[model samples]
Target: MFTAESSFTGDFKLVPLKWAERARKSYPLESTSTAKAVNYGMYTPESMWNKCTYVISELLNECLVGSWVFAISPTAADLSTIASWISDILVDSASLVLVVLEWFQVLSAWEKTFGMPVLTRQDSEVTYSIVPAKCYWTVFAHAGASWQAKHVELVTQLREKVAIRKAAAANKQKRPEDDEDDDEVDARLHKARKRPQKNENKMQTILPTEKAKAAQQVEQPEEEEAVDICSDDSDDGYIYSDEDYSE
Candidate 1:
């Protein structure tokens, strides 16, 4: 069960109720504003308030049963404050002023149960409470065993959804990095295939093959000239005989 105070402060926005005239004509309600006021007043009426309480209690019981079933079948529990709040609201309808007030208590209970801090306006005076964690889980375990199979199925589905979402996010994050690596590899391959081969061909062409051959031929003539000059040189002016030259 839950208890909460209503501190929601805001101006009401009037919606033009269609069939306002027809409804008034049939029901003798004085005006649309009167009808609205009467409807609002019903929650505060003692008899009507008890009926509302009963309904809220039933809802809370159902949430507890469902939550218990869900919690025990799986090792994991829903730490979501919303789920806790729903459970609390079901049990504590007597304390809720309006549906909105009920929601606030449920949220507060959830936060408190999960060790989360509550956020409130500086001027607001809202607070909530529920059973502690160990007792809560123990109660859930006791109640949940009967509905274990269904609870397991529900939790499995939820976990699968979470896993799928996480995987999709990981893939989304990795896609760009993969693309960047591919671009770099492609750029390197393209440079290797296109640019380096052309440079190698240009290098081959630039080598001085013709000039080297020409230089070799010119050096051969110089060497022959030096040999002839050496042979002709002598202190005496007389030429050697053919036999002496052969020797």
Candidate 2:
């Protein structure tokens, strides 16, 4: 997102060399031949400084927006404070919610991608909170709590197929007499998975159900083709974005 080239305009390729030459030319000659000349050059152009400041401000704004969204605790007081902060920022008063939401208009889009920004009503007081993007485990647990026996059984079956296979393979080289067929090993694994009584109530489903996957597909259809975000097509280690923000 950010690049070094964005800090300057025009032919800045020779700026460093030019600055060195200027420093040498401007240096005052000392009368004593043995005296060491230590010239500190502060020769940055005004345009370069302004460009750098703009880039820094933009980066800070993005960071503020991201951190505020992710790190804030889910609380009414915090929500109210942030809302007021946003209001102040919109009026050019700057209360640290650094995003220019008017420019990108991606706040609501992000909410859709993550989850609903939850609102709670307690008596006469109404409070709002943003659910974190990576709360899938919490969401699934809440959903799976009221699941029917059929759904629970289905999820359990679909959940740990890979783990089961891995355990089977690992145990295959154990003792000659202990060696067992895949079916036997699988059955053993299923029995072993059920042995942990503490998590019996908790749904063990990490992956989504087939029906849910299908529903998601229907809701958000895939693009015709994948679009690469990198500016350059080369497979070199360096990545370049289109939003270089050059002056």
Candidate 3:
């Protein structure tokens, strides 16, 4: 978990506005005019917004140890926007800390109220701190025009990946309607096996015992059948007489 205070050093070395003003006065008028023209009077503000942005960005890039970064341009709207962006990043970082704190609080409350341990050991506690120097370096790297767009694209890719993962997890929890279709197919197969067939050949073949019993009960007289058989038989046990019977 990360906290705003822990993610950024509370002790930032900010140069006073008076010092910047004094420094600006020391520069030649021609240089001052050129800088002013190029930066839209970025150096004049009493809040030292441009100076803070430059310092913070440089520090973040140089240190490379923390998440704090001055992302806004020095020529941006005003001190308010810079302050707001910094505050927003701090709040975002702090929210992660708050979440972990809330989770622990909930666990503690559960343990006290229900008399059951929610966590096994206090040794598993996590600690957070800002790596001020590294954080400054990271911010400085993005100060370049090309790097800013790259950073935006990287952040977008990360967000998209997270969304895809969340969707996959949600899909894993859902039961699709195909299961019901499978059940219906099984029921139909069971019903088909139980139902009687309309075709005579199919029905007769299926019920062999009934067909055999019916055939046995239909008896023919042996004496009448024997006389017909004897009249039909010829010398060589042929049913029809031929012109030649040598054998």
Candidate 4:
């Protein structure tokens, strides 16, 4: 439902485009050179960027109102900048749960999204945690048996939501064949319909029951004509023939 023209409004469009254009300073896309040389041009990236925007917007729109997961696997030039643009667009949305994975390596602020710090170093090794929603983000951040148990439980619940979303998406993308196994379903239905049945006999009934047609053919009693018994010029008074009833 989210089209490029309708999804972004006022500042939503302006801010992201501004950020994407600004990121050209670091990322250096091909469009940047054209815009700089022309001195007046829109610094829009390739069409692929628009597709990415559409998908992200659609997922976030769903996530804002419904239970869904909006994931971003950033692998391109200026990823941090792209991350910031994503943050700006999602900043105003309520109930937004963001998860960041520093798969390549942790940037300066890779440990957080929306300023909720989630990365920590435990025993001189890297570790990650989920900062639950509360007045205090560090409610369950402490390293203790109780805190660990609670964090695990909360993360498990979040994963369950993601799983539900995945399952729903899978079902939404399924084809008719996925639900049907019979190859002769259409053939059987066609054969069933083609079979002669008694239902149609009422329309084409046999001759004996066709009373309306028979009644129209039955002759009616004809009124008699007055005889010319006193005719002056008659040989046998009048003449009647078989042709008289032919009319």
On lDDT, the candidate that comes out on top is 1
Q: Write the per-residue lDDT of candidate 4 for residues 119-183, one digit (tens) a residue.
A: 33324442221112211223532334464345446545655777798899888885878547455
Clash totals in order: 2, 0, 16, 0
Worst 10 residues of 2 by lDDT: 87-96
lDDT of 2 by residue, 100-157 (tens): 2111112333356657553222353423232211122223333432322333343344
Question: What ranges in model 2 sit over 4 Å off?
Answer: 1-105, 108-150, 159-163, 174-247
Question: If ranked by TM-score, best first, what sequence of candidates would result?
Answer: 4, 3, 1, 2
Against the true structure, what is every candidate's RMSD? 18.9, 46.0, 19.3, 20.6
* lDDT of each residue in 1-247, candidate 1, tens digit only: 3312221111011223466444211212122122232122322222221101211122232222113211111123553333223122111122221221211322243365768645432245432222211123433433543433333344456556767988988877757779999999999999889978899888887677877888889888544434553365787976677788789
lDDT of 4 at 117: 33
lDDT of 2 at 92: 11
lDDT by candidate, in order shown: 0.35, 0.31, 0.34, 0.34
What C-alpha lDDT does candidate 4 achieve relative to the native structure? 0.34
Candidates sorted on lDDT, descending: 1, 4, 3, 2
Compose the digit string of candidate 3's lDDT tens values, residues 1-247.
1323322322123324574365422222223212223232312222112112111232222212222333332333442211111211111111110000100112444466878645422255532211111122234333544542444354456556767988999887736687788789999998887665546667677799887777877874445434553375456666643434434
How far off is model 3, as Cα RMSD? 19.3
Which candidate ranks first by TM-score, i.e. highest? 4
Q: Provide the lowest-lDDT 10-residue window in model 4.
A: 83-92
Q: What would the TM-score be for candidate 3 when compared with the true structure? A: 0.27
